[model samples]
Target chain A: MASALARTTYNVFFRRSSNYLVGIFAGAFAFEIAFDSAADRLWDMANKGRQWKDIRSKYIQAADSEPADDEE
Target chain B: MFTRAAYTTATRAAFRAPTFAQARNASTQAANGAFGADRKAAAAWFAKAAAGSAILGYGISNYVVTDDRLAPVTKAVAESMTALQKKAAEYGIEMPFTVAHAFSTADHGLHPPHYPWDHFKPWKTYDHASIRRGFQVYKEVCSACHSMEYIHYRNLVGVSHTESEAKELAAEYEYEDGPNDKGEMFMRPGKLTDPMPSPYPNEEAARAANGGAYPPDLSCIARARHGEEDYIFALLLGYCDPPAGVNVREGLHYNPYFPGGAIAMARAIYDEVVEYEDGTPNNASQLAKDVSTFLSWASYPEHDERKKMGLKTLAISAMLLGLSVWWKRFKWSYIKTRKIVYKPGKFDEV
Candidate 1:
């Protein structure tokens, strides 16, 4: 049953040489994007509050409020 | 039967004649021309298809299916993958995924907790205001014992101080200068060119003043230490009374963040130790943080510039990668799309 499914898959995607080449290129592109994003997400999670992205909003808010306080 | 034999001989003789050979060559040339035209047409079609597909893929991905729209789907996929890995690990299966531990818990002292430093991010610049305050903390507090030998007053200009401010700060100290007209060394007011003056003239003096424990230079303390800025910040506030059964040597302070848990330099920063010119909080932790930042800047003056270069490299590489991908597809299209037919019987007949 697995062999039959594998044969069908090969025929659908790999039988044509052009289809095989395109699949390889597209797969590589997708893998690079996926891996990079995954690793970045994991790093961001590990350093949860230590990254600039985590604190940028609060920093901007504080800066915004400071002028108001000075005016008061 | 005789006439048929004569006709066969004539036909065989015609096959070896120059005119017959010329006709064969003409037909072969015609066939080659047709094949060439077919290949040219195929190549044009392939080029068009490749360019159209690339444009369509880029357009669809950029406008129709944008990153923000796909973010949730990508996040869900990542979460599921992580969950699957965790489940596998629970069943004594080893997944080929590992993250380096950020905080180390060694046999010596506790690892410093990670703090969200603004400058730690690749694209983020140092909080110049904080750095300025940190310089104050270093000047008023740390410089009493530790010497920043590698740092010059001029180095502070444009980073934590203005040129005039740095010059004024430099002038506060006195430096030994060469003899002018006399063969003797004389003391001169400090200049921007002079390195930060040592508290003691030499290491021996430093050790003698601090009871035989030499104070390390503060110039590269951030890099020299195990935990970098985190360790420095923690060591400043990590001072506590010796635990039960632990005998700290006389004149040594106990800071858990330090290796061996016994530091020679006593707690330097305290609440309101040095008042910030910018009216920043004067708490112990704040002072520690500022000093750590200042020392970090001293150790790595080009931190911001390095990150900026990294951002530039990534941006340029991404564009080049897209161009290269398109070029590769275009170059490979002809070879990849071409079809080969097997005509074994025809070749055998020829």
Candidate 2:
């Protein structure tokens, strides 16, 4: 009975350890894909001339004038 | 002790390799191969490892860390974008642009560039030529946009004039809504009741006039920028072709001494933009010096008096503190030296 119990424990440990390794690899791959997507979005906004108008014209006009003194 | 020895032996057994000589020989062979046919492969593996690590690092750090990795890049991008703006500015370009202040309403954002404190050379009094030039810039250039909302007429005495002279200068402007005959509200001369006016009547009018660019009120710009008198002085002079190899994008012009080096204001001063009454050339540097001085004075009109009072208070406090320390030391010494002679066991014998 004790021998059978030891065999069962060994089998359970081996199965779980193999699954953990597989899970680690899958998790890493999923994380990489997500990271790539986010990086692409950031790159588009930053370097690729996404909204030149918002960055350039609006504030220059505001700087030349004055902000609204009236507050809500 | 037996268990510890067994554990150590087991760990060593797991780590044991072949004979030392064989291991060394194998390692040498491996090194030779590594330098030869395996070099490219090894380098590729290293590159792959680095790339993988960077991706992982980016994921973990970006999620966990609040610090921005792209600040310098963001700053560069903002500066570059400014050149595309077509606002009517005194700078050479005429393009304009707009965005909400990159800084949040709760935060004033980044520090503007300025001359290092170590670079400062102190002057004894107002440089008259600079002062005259400053007065001109103040009256013409800055007066059009900003309000010196806190300054009182009584504060202008020391910058360019005596008290009586300041009063004469003060007499030029009048105040509104003063005390009535019944000690209620009425109108009066521009005594202490009035602050400086906004260049525009109101925000809508200001925006309409400037093509939607809101010129910041000058009232506290000097203070807000953490300027020394010379900092303002340097910034005005520092405006030029954004320093060599320095890239200013879109609407931003680079002035190295400007708190941010990307002051949105068109470089307003130029060589001979305004003819100085004192026969000084109205060069950008000279105008900058003058305007900086005038702005400083305008920001803290009674600055000289306040500085003097502060110095006097400091000196008095130092003297008092020194006297107190000396007295305490003398008292302590006297107490220590004056040993009370007494018999140890005779309580009532004295």
Candidate 3:
């Protein structure tokens, strides 16, 4: 049963028709190229591998500091 | 009878083959020759194979792709026209193709405040508690002028509010409905599915409320700017008195993050602006962080789900490619070292 299934897949992919080979290559390549870069866009949201509050404390004027005092 | 006859003939022929180890007559050899029949068979087989492949390719294209495949990739498919345009441009002949943006902000020499979010390193997601607090800030402050027109009460179910809480929250607003049986429009209680109502009726009203400048919608603010969520946090905290050396304009606020260091909208966030229900800090910086994270989630709600799906897709494809390679090698190995032999052919004297 396993051998028969493998043979069917093999024929569909590599031997049955040249069109199947072309479609497989196009589909695989499109998904690889498009999805890889599209997924990377989401990763841009990462901010120095820390939460927003941690990053905020670094620059935000602390409440304890006087209004006139300048933070470098 | 025919089978017996043929068997008898084959036997008689075998018996006569080596009577004296003499050469057979040319006519007899020609009668048994296979070269013409083999050539005819090869041509017929290829004709059928070609027709089959053509039909299969046509059928496959119906599902895989219908339009021209090159349309997506070709920047300019008319290679001749692009070559001509380049040549003409090089010769100082300008065309009307390139248009510049109106009111491009000039550099003010004020450097941008430093913040993280420059790289694709590590990972990020909105803090749910922070997002809830941010929603409070928006409801109490920003909602007076700016609006998040795209978001719906239903969207808050898992991210910020419980399902029943979201339904109750949505019920507070009165949304306008279609014409009734009397041909008059009527007001209806807002549903969980209803979009957040704009603070102002129109753009003109929104602009009038905030001087001449219209407060842009915050629905996609995180994505609209290149800086993403960090820029919004910085902008809220950026407001300050103008530098003494520069002339301060009337009715404009000072923020170095603003392109010209002048902004129409007054500073909105302040320390202890909103009383947090969760007993979290209510400082300006804390509020800014929470609000920015909320806006980020609003811009990209399904980011976590998307990333999970992308990881799964990539892993599955990688496994498929590996399996396909192994299968190809396994099947082709049988034919790799195969050889064939044939008997030497007789040639008639030229």
What does each candidate score in C-alpha RMSD?
Answer: 21.8, 30.6, 18.9
DockQ scores of the candidates: 0.02, 0.01, 0.07
DockQ of 2: 0.01
lDDT, candidate 3, B212-283, per-residue tens: 888889999989875667778888888887777866578788887777778888899999989997688899
i-RMSD per candidate, Å: 11.0, 22.7, 13.8
Angstrom error at residue B286, model 1: 1.1
lDDT of 1 by residue, A16-71 (tens): 99989998999889977876676556545554653334433332333344333211
Higher-scoring candidate on lDDT, 1 or 3? 1
lDDT of 2 at B90: 43
**lDDT against true structure, model 3:** 0.69
TM-score of chain A of each: 0.71, 0.44, 0.40
- DockQ class, candidate 2: incorrect
lDDT of 2 by residue, B259-311 (tens): 54666666666676667765666677767767776676566555534543454
Candidate 1 structure quality by residue, lDDT tens digits, B2-21: 58888789877754433434
Lowest summed lDDT window (length 10), candidate 1 chain B: B26-35
Question: Once superposed on the true structure, which residue ranges of model 3 sit more than 4 Å away at CA?
Answer: A1-72, B1-124, B328-350
